[model samples]
Target: MPYKANVVVRYKKSVLEPQGQAILLSLREQGDESFLDVRVGKYIEILLEAENLQAAEEKVRKLAEDLLHNPVMENCSITVSQDD
Candidate 1:
């Protein structure tokens, strides 16, 4: 079976997000003061073969932790689904 994984990587609260801050500043400069803050993150989609949903989730989670995100400075979330 084929599985799809969606991974989201974001900076930890204790880490400074310079890119996010730059975006927020740009938005404010464009006259968008309605936004208080902004945090930028990365979204990755992966397709892989797995025996079951549980196996897919576990593999994707491990991938996210090992290669997709920095454990010290970033946090990651993963979603796995069957791919047709």
Candidate 2:
């Protein structure tokens, strides 16, 4: 009965995140080789209830870009749905 918004935030695959690689190495050293293959990335999902799809989409994108993600190192995708 209302508009909903979803935001997904993740690191750019091309960025070299040494920290993530280090964590993977640590996992391997600890003998959890299974975790060694883990490719670390950030993913965030947000749901917004707004008066309209356009508003919800705009609000969520602003929130993600301004507050939730590092604009230089990360990127976000947003989707809004309304069937009211």
The lDDT per prediction is 0.92, 0.71
**Candidate 1 RMSD computed on C-alpha atoms after optimal superposition onto the true structure:** 1.2
Q: Candidate 2, residues 1-84: lDDT per residue as tens digits? A: 366666666678878777788988888878887763445555665555787767777787778777888878877777778744
* Per-residue lDDT over 6-79 for candidate 1, one digit per residue giving the tens place of the 0 to 100 score: 99999999998998899999999999998887899999999999999999999998888778999889988888
Highest TM-score against the true fold, candidate: 1
RMSD of each: 1.2, 3.3
Model 1 accuracy (lDDT, Cα): 0.92
Candidate 2: worst-modelled 10 consecutive residues by lDDT: 36-45
